[model samples]
Target: MTSDTPARRRARVFSRRRSAPSRARRRLGAAVRMIAALALAGGVYTAFTPGAFAEDNVQLSAAAQEGKALFDNSCISCHGRDGQGVEERGPSLIGVGSASVEFQVSTGRMPMTRQEAQAEQKTPQFDETQTKQLAQYIQELGGGPELPEGELVEDLKTNPDALARGGELFRINCTSCHGFGGGGGALSSGKFAPSLHDATQEQIYAAMLTGPQNMPVFGDNQLTPDEKREIITYITVQLQDDRDPGGLFNLGRYGPSTEGMAIFLVGIVLLVFTSLWIAGKS
Candidate 1:
């Protein structure tokens, strides 16, 4: 017959409180032990597999070595130590390839002055030789789509059949973004489809190969080498010709948009002047 004494109840409550703390301590200790074990396992795995994760010691060619130095000096802040890319700054260049580098550097679209919606074409920071070196470093880091050798548009010049094929291809694949006359157009974001009138053959080829920015990659599976060359010919030769059948001024060649704007402005001016002349005659 145990009586319900206040002291007895107090003692039981105190014991329960003590047990809870002990249980919590045990759980915390177990968690610490598990974390320590995981850390040890990771260290051991990394130590045993040196070459599997790191390429720091891999020997580089002379050009690649120079490129490395250039990258570290000018590009490391954005591109990261091994061209892995910096967070919220640049993208990983691992598989972007030399052609991409050539296009970006040659067009002066990189070594960006500031982070914007897109990199715009400007005066190049590196010369042709230096650009190649930077590209070589990226290529050696991880091989990617390479630039085609020799003249890309030469063969298409002699073949009228191929030139026609190129025009059709451009209309199908590029006109949606670049506009019918290649004057370029606005995109969803701050980015824009640049005017192809200024783009060179190499730049066009690289743009298609790497699919810079919004452009999709046109690999061999999509557009064959011969097909690529033909497209380049259509843009550089036919589109660039100063002799427009319609008139001297191309009016930006932006299809209906440019023409509409021009007509609206010119019409407004004429209407204002015509009203003024009628008032004076009256």
Candidate 2:
């Protein structure tokens, strides 16, 4: 019979340790199995989820297809293939959606005429149908903010309450950048807040949703749908009609700065002119 001495016990322990995998090896094996199990679970979930399948199997509509064609011909230069966008040339349009495309194309801001500090509004290259098709293509490529259906305040012109509410909303939300009159104000850098005078309801809504250029996005979370409609009503009904005092005397409607300049410069010039006339008559 072998006595269980410390030497014999040490030998047995070493043998067991040798027979078993090293701690590092055991941990590596466990990690590999865990990863494989997770991968299998993910695969099953992806296969079973209807939403995942729908997103993966989506096919472009006719309008989207036509828009893709137009994009290939016209927008591909800077935006790149599949609208991935080229570095430094243009931003990726994948997630921008239809609202952004409509606002840019309809307002004739995209397909920019030479890269400047900002893309100013010009005559649109694409007409309404083409613009819609383009917007649809972008909307399908990557889902994003979309304009709600039905009227965006068609009756706002007649609704005095709506106009009043809208004016108040506009004053609170828009007065800083757009100025009190919505004639638009100069921003830092070359970018400027655009005049909202001629902007249509759709355009205004789109701008609010997308936040073109320096404009901050007024998402539904910040401003509800009805509030947007009211603001649109105010802009269309009140601001558009709020004309400047006519003639060359009005100068640019930069609010107080221009008013102050008119008071100082024009007042001094009138005084000088009246003095000369009085002296000559005497």
Using all chains and alpha carbons, the TM-scores for the candidates as numbered come to: 0.74, 0.81
- How well does candidate 1 match the true structure in TM-score terms? 0.74
lDDT of 2 by residue, 1-282 (tens): 978999999999998898677776899999999999999999999887542211434599999999989999999999987777889898888778799999999999999968898899999999999999999988887677888888889877798999889989999999899988788888988989998988988999999999999999998899999999999988887767655523334456444567777689989999999999999999
Question: Residue 31 deviation, candidate 2, in Å?
Answer: 2.8
Instruction: Give the top-scoring candidate (TM-score).
Output: 2
Q: What C-alpha lDDT values do all the predictions have?
A: 0.86, 0.86
Kindly give the stretch of ten consecutive residues in candidate 2 with the minimal lDDT sum: 49-58
Cα lDDT tens digits, model 1, 157-181, are 8788887899899999999999777
Off by over 4 Å in 1: 1-54, 243-246, 255-282
